[model samples]
Target: MKKKLRIGILFGGRSGEHEVSLLSAASILKAIDKKKYDVVPIGITREGRWVTADDAHALLTGSQPPENPRLAGDPEATPTAAVIKRGEAIIVPPVPAESLQPLELHAAAELSPARPALALDVVFPVLHGTFGEDGTIQGLFELADIAYVGSGVLGSAAGMDKAAMKKLFAAEGLPQTPYLAVLRSVWRGNPKAATKKIETALRYPLFVKPANLGSSVGISKVHDRSELAAAMDLAASFDRKLVIEQGVGGPGAKPRELEVAVLGNDSPEASVVGEIVPGSEFYDYEAKYLSDASVPIIPAKLTAAESKQIRQMAIEAFKACDCSGLARVDFLMEPAKGKTKPRIYLNEINTLPGFTSISMYPKLWQATGLPYKQLIDRLIQLAVERHREKHQTRFTRV
Candidate 1:
């Protein structure tokens, strides 16, 4: 019999999307093919602890329903102090001394017992936001010389920052909404100056968002000048930079939101377009994960030409950002009025989009003839393939 490949399903990260990551991991754990792979579930707590066994089990079981797998540990267990060394995650006890100086010992230093390693062949980082989605962890993976799912450092960082992402799209000649990027320090240093700049550059009814966050955590829709200060404050609290975008619609017409999923390393393919009808005034975090009012229309009602244009644009944006594995390219479609045709503005690319049951990334692929389980398998394969290809480059000249 062929030996099973040891696959690590890493989840529960130090980000606002911790719960969402847990949910995504749980979905994968339930669906992942057990016969072909030896699975190890690695959990990272909000305190930034890398844990396995009981601690990881507790967190996963506690967050999941009774029907899911439960562990033999306290539901509210304290996290352990662990670190990754030599490609293995080890639980290191607290250092005894408070001094920052290096210890001087004449070959008399005590050594701790060796901790067993997970010996993972590949890692599937189901983490989102900050340390997870912003390319930080991907950088670690590259340094550790391990294969992991999703984009590399460059693509992840570019995809995470809205300002940088828009610049890349513009360079590729992709159509997008006009916006202004603001610094939190600049806004706080001179509120008058920042407000005047924003007002002068863009119109009212703007979307204020934290440049480095997602899931609409620090997002506000300001209708007028009176609401701009509050929105800026809210966004500044979340990130060092804030992005204020011009709203897509006019008067009473609502901007229809559309999304297309892209998958692959070099020659990526785009999924059939999907439309989102938000339940709230905008598609905030609550409407995305909590409420049932929001509806998703698969193969969104579009003319053949419109569908072809958006799908092709989605692929262009994905490559422009240097994304791999998978991404969900979002757009804002202005409703056609009079002789004016519908205008599609490339919103942004999510290098690591949601994978929950109700998430659009997986659903788009399911509609495109790739089921959830097969999609997960394909992602893992892509990671290994990308890693192998990357090894071909020589670090030093002979």
Candidate 2:
């Protein structure tokens, strides 16, 4: 029999999106092709404890942590940065050897484990937000010389920061709503001045967001000066910087939420357009995961030409940000009510979009004829292909 590739599935990270990660990982773990791959479920608890199990899906979906998280050499208590002298963890070779074989160390050093949790052929990080999605974990994968699915450190960090992404989009001649970014220091030292700066740049009904987070953890739509200060404070609570974007899809605006999925490396392809009908005030955390009321319109109701144009724009947006593996580019469509030509505005892109059964990313692909299982296979293949390309690059110049 051919040897199976050992894939590490990481989920339940230290972020507001912990539960969301688990859901994504659960779906991925369920759909992976076991014949071609050996699954390794490594879960990080809310307190940051690392645990391996045959049932990571259950642990993640349920509210409580695992019953037997402590392996023989597993630590008595979990550490934040993960010092695995004695814990349900394994060492991934941070520095590489000339021959390219990674050093695999177990927690007990005597477990005789079939495969050390750390020595993965590739990793699929189903984590979102904070350390998980914002380049920190991606950097770890880079240093450990492990092949990880999704964007690299630069792309992940840039994608996490709305202000940075906007700057890149602007430089690429991409259209974006007017916005302002404020630092925590400035807000704390002179909040009034910070508020004035925001007031000066954009109009009211602005969306104040924590510059580095998603799942709408800290976001608000401020209609007036009275709410602007409070909204900034709320966003500042989640991250050091806060972003305020002009309200684009409200009462007077188009109010359309469109999504496009991009796949592969250098020459990525865009999937047919999808639409989101948020179940709440907007696509907030609860409306995204908990609510069943929200709906997605696959091959969204639009003219053939309009759909083609939106999909094309989505690809440009993905390339503009130098994305890899996969991304979901979201846009807003301002349809003509009577006289004006309809305008399509690119909102933002999610490098690591949710894989919930209801999430638009996977749903769009499934509609494109790739089932969940096949989609997982394709992504794993992409990871290996990308890794091979990187391996061919020489580190030192003669």
Candidate 3:
């Protein structure tokens, strides 16, 4: 009999998007095919502490695990034992051990009975921001020589920082909005000088964002000099680097928000285009997660030529950032004026995008003929394939 693969779903991270990550993880836990896999739930607290399966499940669903979980095609099998304590931290050793070792840090002094280390065939990280999505965790996975989902270190890091992503896009000759990267120190040291530089280089109605954040957590829209100072202050509080982006479209017109999901490695494919109609003036954090008025249009209405151009640009943006596994490339299309065709500009690429059931990444793939479960399966397969390719490299002298 073929042994079922053990899959680890890692979630809850130290980031502004922590709650959003929890929602994404819950959707995956419910939708994943448990019949063909032994699903293990691993979670990290906001304080960066890793917890066991039962604790992780409880944290996610606010309920305890069943005394015995049903195995695939078996009703009379022996009960599976819990491997680690509920609150104990699970450490991924830098050395290649292929198992997550649990550090016993409980108050009790005695050691427990011998148990096998929790082995994972592959890790699906639903962590959405900072430490989890910004290449730190990917680096740890590389050190452990484990197969995991999403882009590698460089891609993840570049995708997380807006300044770096825009630079890469420019280097690839992809069309993008004008923007400036400002260090928090420089801005704070001379607010007048920073304001002058930004105003001189870009027009009003600019977007102020923390370069290293996702989910629009520290993003602000500024219309004039008075608004710029406050926006800079808000963005500077979140990150050391800030990105001021020029807005698209003319007066009183909003640019259309389009997104395309890219999947695979080496040779990647672009999904059907989707659009977001922001409930607010722009797609801020509140309008994205908290508001109920925002709407998502799958297979966004566009001319065949427009769709093809945006889709191709999405793939180009993905490759330019060296992304793998999956990414959602965003673009802004200026409002058509005086019978002229609208211009499309690549906004950014999200390496590890939102994975909630309703998130655009999965929805775009679904609209492109791939279901959510199948999408997860494909991502896991890609992770293993990439790991195998990495193993082929010669790290030492022959």
Best by TM-score: 3
- Compared with the true structure, all predictions reach lDDT values of 0.81, 0.76, 0.83
Taking the tens digit of each residue's C-alpha lDDT, what string does model 3 give over 7-73? 7888887789988898999999899999877787877666565555566877687554333332121
Per-prediction TM-score, please? Answer: 0.88, 0.88, 0.89
Candidate 1 lDDT over 220-318, as tens digits, reads 988888999999999998899999998897545579999999999999999999999999988999988889999999989999999999999999999
Scanning candidate 3 in windows of ten residues, the lowest lDDT window is 70-79
Model 2 misplacement above 4 A:
54-58, 61-109, 112-118, 249-254
Residue lDDT tens for model 2, 282-346: 67777887888888889899889989988888888787777789888988776466876677788
Candidate 2 positional error at 376, Å: 0.6
What is the Cα-based TM-score of model 1? 0.88
